[model samples]
Target: MTANVQNLNAERYSNEVFELWANQQNLNKSEDYLLKKYITDTSKHVLEAGTGGGRLSFYIEEKGFNNISAFDVVPNMIAHAKKRASTNDSNINFSISDAAVLENYESNSFDYLVYLQQVLCFIDKKDLFTNALKEAYRVAKKDAIVMFSFLDYESKIYNPALSSFVNVLRKLRSEEQSSRHLPWLKINNDINWKLFHKNQPKTYWVKRAEITSLLEDIGFSIEEVKNANQFSKNTGKRKGILYVVCKK
Candidate 1:
């Protein structure tokens, strides 16, 4: 992962208001289909990787999933999450962690793990992304459900997030060279499209096949895969984040 990507991830989600926006996302749905369908027992130990501002953590708690812990690479984001947790009196253990290296967690510690909101895309290096998957796989128990979501390369428009990153690339390189030297490098046999989001820093995207193969390689079985945005339709069609549900 590039230092630029790391700095960007830290800089973007520093605000407290973003947490409210994150929580507001699933209000329309009567059920968290991903959580409800895959996670039946509220007692299961849950971990939210890349838990920005603890929005999903808060939501999962509302649904009675009490055994939850969350982490983020950004300290300010974790601070915001901690503030929210304090306000709500939620017993969620918030911590600082890198997905590729779960320094604090032990193997087989959690029953359910969620890498939501395209957070996986933030690890700019494909190998780092894979290593993170390996860590996630290691920490989760057998038959555990793991859900990862990302912004699709085939999205209808270039989101503001992409625009910000593009602008950064443009600044680093001459317009002529940047056109050629974008972040989309073809790494060893992984993904042709590991595009990260700009606004949210390390947030990025990869092909579904690459994700599936990587998960299987790391011992996860594919259960269901779909665009997370499918739940929220706009302009008469589903548009937004790509996601997968896997069982370990």
Candidate 2:
């Protein structure tokens, strides 16, 4: 089952496609802010789950984090990450591992754990997310920081233009094999063809209350939930992202 999921992800987002998608998204400002907030005044071990292409991990390394490890479920993604590390001469340990299962990492082994963007949504299992949280908590010292971001559903409904743009992009990616807007090569398999045709890849939306409640249920207290509008002074329509910082 895990292998199937990995293969799907690999086929959907190959190295070229992943690079193109990463380049298209102007996420550096937000990612930099979040990384600074999480990696401040601490010299403890850090782990980035779902570290596709080692993009965020590399950014964190550039910001002076010495002890950092990264993992992705897809082997091809991990391979791309390794190539990235070598190209940049970074010493990050890139591995292929499931975020939901962290039994190999010993208890109290890390001081920080981060999941950028929509890493949690890809799990497809609430129990798996809960278990991942539990494992993160177990492997962190008291007061360790865990930070992540998600789509704010409330804000999303207010931006029809952006919503329509996303829909059009999805449609283009699904229908046009030669669309350079997407990074992955054209998939020819029937299952993949049906999957892509039926499911448009849009952002996953979660309510603030639901996120806070989940953190609390998982034995972490939320330190802050920074709406994107607060930092940018943009209207609610522009603040489609939410960043949550919690302490374990």
Q: Using lDDT as the measure, which candidate wins?
A: 1
Q: TM-score of each candidate? A: 0.74, 0.74
Q: Write the per-residue lDDT of candidate 2 for residues 84-186, one digit (tens) a residue.
A: 7898899888887776787557787778888776565555345565566677678777888888777666665544554455457667666432121122113
Give the TM-score comparing model 2 with the true structure, all chains together. Answer: 0.74
Instruction: Give the best candidate by TM-score.
Output: 1
In lDDT terms, how accurate is model 1?
0.70
**Candidate 1 error regions (>4 Å):** 15-31, 156-203, 229-238
Per-residue lDDT tens digits for candidate 1, residues 1-248, read 23555555455455423444334445334126676677668989999988877877887888898899999888867887898889989999999888988988999999989887667676755667778899999999988888888656556355445556676665665432212113443333345354433322334556567768878988899987776566655343435666688888
